[model samples]
Target: MNRSAAEKEYEVNYYEIDYNEKLLITGLVNYFGDIATRHFENVGGSLTYSKEKGMAWVLYKWNIDINRYPKYGQKIKVRTNAYSFRKFYGYRTFEAFDEKDNIIARANSIWLLIDTNKRRILRIGEDMYKIFGLTKKDNKPLFIKKVKLPEKFSIEKSFNVRYSDIDTNRHVNNVKYIDWILETIPLDIILKYTIKHINITYEKEALYGEKIKIFTELKKQDEEGYISLHKIVDEKGKELSVIEAIWGIEEK
Candidate 1:
């Protein structure tokens, strides 16, 4: 069934904002992901289906573009839709809007439905696929998925996964991976440049209590923006997630 895109209204919570009183990038991502899950739950893609099928949805990668970051007390609406699937991959898109219906941010993500017990991608079944109104065609993204980072990097800092970082899935939430990456950048870089785009690939789950180091490198830059690469790794140096962030000063 072709369902209307799922939309939910929200107020930028005080706690979810940064020192600048604007919504944090991590917080925006959490809301975006929640909207996608909420869309699934509404259209017969219930938790019961997931459990009974022994399948769990895993995000493969995301490409997010930010136009304006809403500030505290701002009213916003998030819309999400699952569009297509092939093999083991599903495609979805989400958008965030301000009160005037102006777009604030948008993201395109790829996900995989996996057998939870087997820890491998599961060929999507008809019932589950039908619920998402899945098709073979792609929900093509607005921008090219071409963010690139250099091979070289520097060890920036380490963080311990605390209770706060774990989500309902008993793993470090995907948003925390973005947080970990942001934490490694210099304060000046973060303050001076607005994050216009971010590309992240989740490699492995970083469990609670694990200590992870953030390795970073400032990639090449030109008329578009500066690209920065980040790798979140465990104490033994095994990589957990890979991220590339594009930052630039807002145009006058």
Candidate 2:
């Protein structure tokens, strides 16, 4: 079954917004994930089918840019497409648009299909490509700069993985990592700036009941904006994920 991109519409709920009444980044990510799953199901890769086959697609990296945060009660449309596939990787794009059809946020991501039973990445066969309607493309890199860890972190905090943080996959959901990273950011930056860009690379997974530490460094700050780096590590200090964030001055 060949299909183009798929889309879904959603309304920003009151619970999805932050204290400032703007949609939270994690809420937007939920919408993106929902659309991607629905699109895959539309293409015949239903969650049930994948589970029965002991297969699952795991996020490897994220590059998201937000133009402006949508307010509560606003309606937005999300679109996603599986654009390219490599041996063991899939490349996809997602966009969120306002009621006026203007894009408010866009993201590019990399995913790896893995054998759930074996816990290893599986090669993308021709069948997988046909199912997703993916075509080969030139390997122009999707990301310009890689997410880098800070040379030394100034602030660090540790937390135990909560049951609620675990998703259907039996591991902490990707978005939960963002929540952990945000906790270490300076309160001043969180209050005075709005996140405009985010880049995250997943290295490992965290399971329930495990303790994890987040190290954050405010690398740069000026009149225009701020840059923050975060690293999540397991109890043994094993790297789980690294993130870089860019924030712009909040409009007064």
Candidate 3:
């Protein structure tokens, strides 16, 4: 079977905006996921396993690059397409544009098929391959590099995972983890800065009962005062995820 492309549009909602009155970065990512998931489900694909003994899709990694932030009450069109499949992984690409067709952000993600019962990776089945029309691509997807946090990082805030933080998978959702890490930075810093790139590595799952320690370190790279390093660690001091965010002043 051959894989095909899917695209959808969305209007920025009030609830999706951040305190800065712009679409929340994390919320934007969630919207992309929601639309993409719906597109697959409409075609009889499963984002998570159902009762009939099937597997679900799990995000293995994502590379997101933002050019500009979307404002509240803006209508944005998000285009998504299934590009390829390899063994247990499916590669998808997403592009977001404003009403005028200006590109806001673009992302590429690798998803793994997982067996719900066995908690193991599953190969792409014939049915899904046919439905999604999975095919082979010539070039490899661009992957964000995972940088380790420096040893001199200092803890700025600590947070305990709440029940609300847990997703249907019973683990902290990826976006929420990014939110927690962002909360450690001051508002002034956020308002004046724009995130150019973010790369995160999911090491271990954070359960509801676990407390997360947030640490951050900033450094100047050329003219950009980048938030060079960020990390989340469990109660036992084991790292959960390491994120490196590069930021610069919004271009006039």
Summed backbone clashes in each candidate are 0, 0, 3
Q: TM-scores of all models? A: 0.89, 0.95, 0.88
TM-score ranking, high to low: 2, 1, 3
> How many clashes in candidate 1?
0
Q: Which is the leading candidate under lDDT?
A: 2
Clashing pairs in 2: none
On a 0 to 1 TM-score scale, where does candidate 3 land against the true structure?
A: 0.88
Model 3: per-residue Cα lDDT over 1-252, one tens digit each:
223666678888889887767787888889877877776876766544343555667676777888887888888888888777777767788899989999989888778777766778888777777777654442255465658678887647899999988876667888887789788777777877878777777777788978889888887777665665888889999988888888887654
> CA lDDT of 128 in candidate 2?
75
| Candidate 3, pairs of clashing residues | 2-133, 3-133, 3-134
Worst 10 residues of 1 by lDDT: 135-144
Question: lDDT (0-100) at residue 121 of candidate 2?
Answer: 91
For model 1, how does the per-residue alpha-carbon lDDT over 10-103 read when each residue is reduced to its tens digit?
8999999988788888889989888888888888776777878788888888989999899999999998877666667777888999999998
Model 1, runs deviating above 4 Å: 135-147, 219-225
What residue pairs are clashing in model 1? Answer: none
**Root mean square deviation (Cα) for candidate 2:** 1.7
User: Model 3 Cα displacement at 143 (Å)?
Assistant: 3.0
| lDDT ranking, best first | 2, 1, 3
